[model samples]
Target: MTGPDRRTVTSHLLIAGMSAMIPARSIAATRDPTARTRQGQAKGFVRNGASIFLGLPYGADTGGARRFRPPAPPLPWQGVRDATRPGQRAPQPGIGPLRGPFADYFTGNRSAEIAAMPETLGEDCLVLNVVTPAVDRARRPVLVYIHGGGFTTGTGLVGTLGDRFTVAEDVVLVTVNHRLGALGFMYLGGASPDFADGNPGMLDLVAALRWVRDNIGAFGGDPTNVTLFGESGGGIKVSLLLAMPQAQGLFRRAIIESGLYPDPIAPQVAADQTRDFMARVGASDVAALQRLPFDRFSGAGTPGNLPVADGRTLMARPWAQAPATAANVPLLLGYCKDELTLFALGQPALFDLKWPDVPSRLAAAKLGLPPEAAPGVVDAYRSVFPSDTPSDSYFRISSDASFGRAMVTLADLKSGQRPPVYFYRMDLDTQLPPGLRAMHTAELPLTIGLSPRADADTLTKQISGAWAAFARTGDPNHPGLPQWRPYRPAEREMMVFDQVSSSGPDPQAAPRAMLREAIGSGAQYNPL
Candidate 1:
């Protein structure tokens, strides 16, 4: 069957099981429940005592004129919308042999997940998934999550499973879908008046937040008490949102994991990149570019896309200069140990290099420490990690450049503000692959309590509890776990989350200190 017909068949099959599985509960009953949306009036399941509304449209399709532009509101429908199943994924450019331990994480389980993905590309990609404990009118705190994929790939559905937070903390969890890559971040600053801006993906996020602020009460969530949290690219998006004026009052708290916004692309740089991308695709105008095949716009050959400092929407560099508007929002920021290990696994050349050659290679990329700090940085790392090899140094260097330094930089900057700042180092290793280490995104399964292995259950429970507690209250401190103190300049206390969690002054002291000094002193590492 053709794409459209296949989508219709899939939608029909998904909706068929909705009625039998989702029993309606009375509004006044102890188990408060309600309909999904006006169009897809499908009832939600009471799994683990929480009601879920899946694939609820917050904005209309981005087809034709709508593509590459800001998201538009969904059209009003006649009846309850069947929000029983997930909506189609945003159109992604297909390309390359997927690399690394997390390649499948991005390509998704094609046979299982993408087969159910919506087939057609359109303006209708703006939708959200929500899980809440009750549909009563009582307003519970809400957590709006944005997923991460280096600004090129990923969906909210893939990273989050809201059952733990919703049922455990009695909070509402909302995950949103937004434009990515070229469609999201193409800067048209000098090209056209209308397209003369950056961060279209971020704009989509703000639109989703606006929807939450306006309509979340209907789903038993408080519009005013919202927390924005994400991992990797999602975390970077949160950092950008923290700096955005439009997103200021929409969220009260923020959690950033393995990402920060210190190295936003300058507007001129973004425009130049856009020019190069257009040249590659043979498109002279926005209209011509939009008309190209969606695959041509998205595939592996597509240029890297990220939020740009457009001067208007994005007022200033987020990590470098704190937005005056976001100065007061409480922040929980952190990174996973061995974050770059997975990314480095895909590039064997990095693994083959000699330990002594590591510093020179970094210096060649302008990411070297000052001559004074270079030997000390290497020595400090080696002193702590006696058996460290070139591969380990590669992981350490890349991790610090892309995620670790960024995390510390943001924390240090934000610590000077009013609202308290907290940080952690996630050391939980996964069972997926040995070489993966405590790689980036490994903390996700644990934080969301989705790990299927019996061995990981204890860790999952602890981490999930901490996250839920933080969602419920601004603080992440729980009863059984060691006290996770706020990140203060004096003590610099950080929680080390592992099989046996601990809290003290900077566990990775030598590496963290060396990285902080190196980056502060003009080292030029690439931000992932």
Candidate 2:
């Protein structure tokens, strides 16, 4: 892994006597193998007996005029494209300062870790990675993973757990990176017609799907059977793709894990973007906004990266209506038992709450519940979980509000229709820190074989079995788990996943009423 003795390679030219910024090991390890993607031939490396291709471009340069618009097809190349080095991530704020114990979760401390993170950011970020048992094999189910960071941060790099889905699963795993924040989703309709319904970030995902449709076969995948699966923010994209007309027919199945956001793209972003955009880049007009350096414009992402309903690509906000476009696409939706604690516990009061502080703290938590609704929520939680403390109750209530409700609601909406929705809940204990049981993103490493505990492997095997079966047949039922049932509006049925998985009635019925009353209609919060 020494940083030495190398050559420079760009899209067109390479110079001698210059050091290759990528590690020397990566350069030598991958120089022998090559595969033809739709855009061009890509050079790749090998790991764990799998062909590991990194940073393969799926769209053209997305800077200057191309900023804040749908992605253009990648420019075809004359020579082989070098995909050994990690591509630059979309520009957004990376992890800020952290406090005690919890900092371990963000630092990526897995023993079977992937390679390092990309050290730079750029607008040329619409690239994807491919990991296959062998490019020579054909018709294998393709898993196109959308990395989570909402409409903003996170890349399809090693940091996002891309390498974990390699040969072990016998599916071609594809991870993608696209535009984020202002450069990807800020609405500037006055600037141009193309930028009217601003959701360039979502469009980037659509383009990536289109790329998969055309080129995944070369990597030993069945493009017709692509399964779009993601976690956290990535799961939100999978849900959006299901409702988006532009994303129709690109894939056949969807899996959403702990993703929650409002269904429709917001009609108008609450934050004043016009003033912020102008202030950040020293540009008052869309014309001038295009001329500013992308780094400046993208880094100054304020008001967050929310998708706008421009009425063309998205007719209504995603998830608001039954997804007619995805009527025939089977869906598997689930969430971790204590999904919100990873984020909720960051508030010191919630890390461990005293019984006396419970009342005032629950109200002030501002979980979108009204003051009048707080007492009822407290009462219901106390009745259902008698032995639980205030902190435990808050964690469970927040989990149901943010993630659990959405899973059931979407499942009910998609049930008794063209394609069925199967629901599950991950309650496995990895025995991790803070003792927040089954916390958010805890299943990530386990599903990909990073688990150290013996109890986790059984659930991981069942999960992997279900995911693989779903990718192949659009149904997740297998002998590994109990008799899983498809969700129905009239009947409450869901699979509770653990060391010994089994079926049960919808677990949210009682808590949901309280949550809806408190949060008004239903709860919605974009995972940060």
Candidate 3:
């Protein structure tokens, strides 16, 4: 058969196969005929003159023996693997009751958005969702996203839909699922052979990267030009991946939001936490631990949880030790305006501390400050925010100690390597009833340029344009947006995203200085 005829026959077969996988009416209604495949099957839906494909998988079921092991290659099928449905999410313990706004957010309430809930949550949760403008086989820049959950919980399924970014930027967007918490991070070498040393979760991330490098081209993504970006725990994972030897060259650029490696944790303390967990669960062997019921292994206070500084996988404490390997990759790091306010929900007393007493409480918490330094720390904070009340002062100190200082410290270290590092401060106040003002995860909608009203064009072409530019070419500069200068100790230029976004010098200058001094130059501390 001629090449054209062969392509036509192949496309037809693929369309037939995909039709069997999903609803025929939905496909017929939404699929673009003009953007048709060789077999006359639609590959994407037309949105503002661009075609969009949602939820394409990159790996197979990670169940049974595949659990705790590297992601297996997705088995090839005859027809187009329904690239529309999002695969299952990894088993994660739910936090609080799922209702109201939380349920709406998790379920994707947008009328234009497609809901891709996982059929099951188990060890077999290794999968990825892809959003591409077209499937014409032309390699486009790829953005591989990792979701955050304190290295314990969270799935790629939450709060990440590429529809806005994909159509707005005309780029391929990929979000992945990896092992989390104990099942992902537990180091088993000391107890069993199959469950040997190193971080299994990190390994899962590397496996996903490898899968992207190998197969992204099939979905119109440039494997060599992938960028890894994440928020919170996901940001921390990106930091770890930068230090990991296995992740080298898989991704070219990175964007970390609200989390940094330099946030100190005592290695021994983490190990002890693991030991206590193992002891509590009554599992001395790795096999037995693996065999534990999923429910028993999940949730808070579980054994063999959280990423450990196992010397091999985690070369050194991320915050204390400079990431020599990732030094060359361009980085973008930042935090929200009122980062600590979210913690007040769980620890109400956090909001009660007086400004002068903030430093003392933090020092006592073993946040790298000496006991005697508490008074001076408080004084320094007061001097910085002289007009602020005790509550404001306390929140500033806590936010800096936990996230802000660490972000700056990492950026400072990376800046020394001569790599372009961009910084930002998200100050937009959503004013949601929860009273979270620019809190963690708040910048997500802005980053993706999503708005509440379907008819409203709140999609700022500038933000999405910059992100697309960055994904396309390692730089976020675009038309109508101010030139984003690389972060430096001297200038400390930060891109502020708010009701009005712009690039400028440090806005929280005094507070930032006090944090740097209190945390020391490296912001390093032994985890208690």
Candidate 4:
């Protein structure tokens, strides 16, 4: 079954670019549990004692000619805006089929999550939510999260993380929704000079940051102390924003949790996808394309939405190495112990493979190495894990090749930065099948202060505290954790979070090196 096919997805405004956008007084507006903005007023209710504001517009609607253009400024209203429910998610192909019996187990939702989503997928999808404990605090550190989906699926879900993140940590929490899929990122630049700016989705994030810089102070946050964090695709975005000059100074700190460094799609690759989109929609020109309804454009069978290096919104190379411009920004990077189990456990195709099949399968997908080198990589992992079955070896190597390499590469890039870059490995095994141990996104709900449980109480306190401390002071050295030294190339140190949590030096060094030797430097191109 295809993952997130044709489906969905969705920062900060640059301080320099947005100086005259919103007034300075707007930053210090009084918080009455009800707040006022330059555009209008919004009343956020209390939940578990935290104030909550849901679905306030941060950017203008994307419809008609505005579709696929850089996000426009939010249109102002005459009356108070009612921010009660979540804003509509970006238009997307729904998460398609799940083949295996335990497919729902892998996703952690049988059908309940899809059932819970709003029925409407609207065009005006640029809105955001804020949760604060008390509006009384003058300078709270802010945590603004961009939801994951690899630029394809996931919404900026609304919640009251206030009890956990805001009240306990005293940091404000903000979640945002931007455009996604073909709606936000269809590359029509070469064909239509009018649509030349390539990264509209990234720009949407910039608009949200602009909103935060001008408005978050009133919600009890410091616009100057904002830290952007996300897991998976969201984490990828956090890293991308770090390199973006347009998003510079919008966020002072960043946490990249299990995110791959996405290289912008090459021009021909984007052109092919655009050609497919145009053919599917029967549009000959960009004007005719914009005239079509959103549903028709949304339905086009196309590739996953990824960014492009048009030299405007993004550099020619997308994080080919450490980002030179944003190297000064403090960063925390990490991934789950079994990052791909979130996908692999449900994939019988991988689990059911025989030893003879592994080489051809790896070659077919070009997972890490060519067919001739697959045996060497398999042996490499066997030397590393030792006890795992052949299938387990395949999955582990794939995980390392994709996400694990990205983590180490980022650590390698930022090894000596003075501002400091931190690294971690989440080894927390779950109650699910052992093969699904510490799967992707396993740390999200608790780490961000979602559902609270007595079992996860200690874990939550530790992980959340590290995140909170990092946001507050750029160092995650709270009393709860081991002294997490800044990652270094020689030692390759990283904090490993598990039941018996501890810090280790070069935990996966042997395996990462093995793959690097086999795949060469091209290993950095592995899609995370």
| Residue-level error in angstroms, candidate 3, position 73 | 3.5
**Best-fitting candidate, scored by lDDT:** 4
In the range 1-528, model 2's lDDT, one tens digit per residue, is 121111111100010000111221233344356888766798877665667777888898788888776789998887988876777667765442222222233222332232333337788888888877787747799888777766666666532232444566677888788888778877776445656766788899999999999988888889899999887777878888888888999999999887775454454542256556677667767778789776565444464466666676665556666678888888988888777666653355575877666656656655676766776787787887798877777777777777777776777777857787888888775454545567776555444444445556677677777787788888887777788888776667888887777797865567667777668763465445
- lDDT for predicted candidate 3 compared with the true structure: 0.62
List the global CA lDDT of all models: 0.67, 0.68, 0.62, 0.69
Lowest summed lDDT window (length 10), candidate 2: 10-19
Measured with C-alpha atoms, the lDDT of residue 252 in candidate 4 is 91
- In TM-score terms, candidate 4 sits at 0.86
In model 2, the runs with Cα more than 4 Å from the true position are: 1-31, 96-119, 159-165, 264-272, 298-304
Model with the higher lDDT, candidate 1 or 2:
2
TM-score of each: 0.84, 0.86, 0.81, 0.86
Candidate 1 per-residue lDDT over residues 1-528, each given as its tens digit: 111122221111111100111112223334324554433344454544677776677788776787777777777776656665667556664322222323233222221222223323433668887888777778988888787766766667643344645777678889888877777777877677888656777888998998888778888898888988888778888988888887889888999888844456788777788788888878898888878766676755465466777887775555565567778788898987777655553355665678777776555434555545665666677777777676676566656665777787788888889888889888766533435556777676566555435565666677777777777778888885798889986678898888788998985666767666676756335434
Where does candidate 4 have its weakest 10-residue lDDT segment?
10-19
Question: Which residue pairs clash within candidate 3?
Answer: 11-39, 12-39, 62-124, 261-319, 262-319, 265-527, 266-527, 355-390
Model 4 per-residue lDDT at 368: 54
Tens-place lDDT digits, model 3, residues 119-196: 355666666655666666789988887877666666664434445567667687777777676677666555545554
Question: lDDT score of model 1?
Answer: 0.67
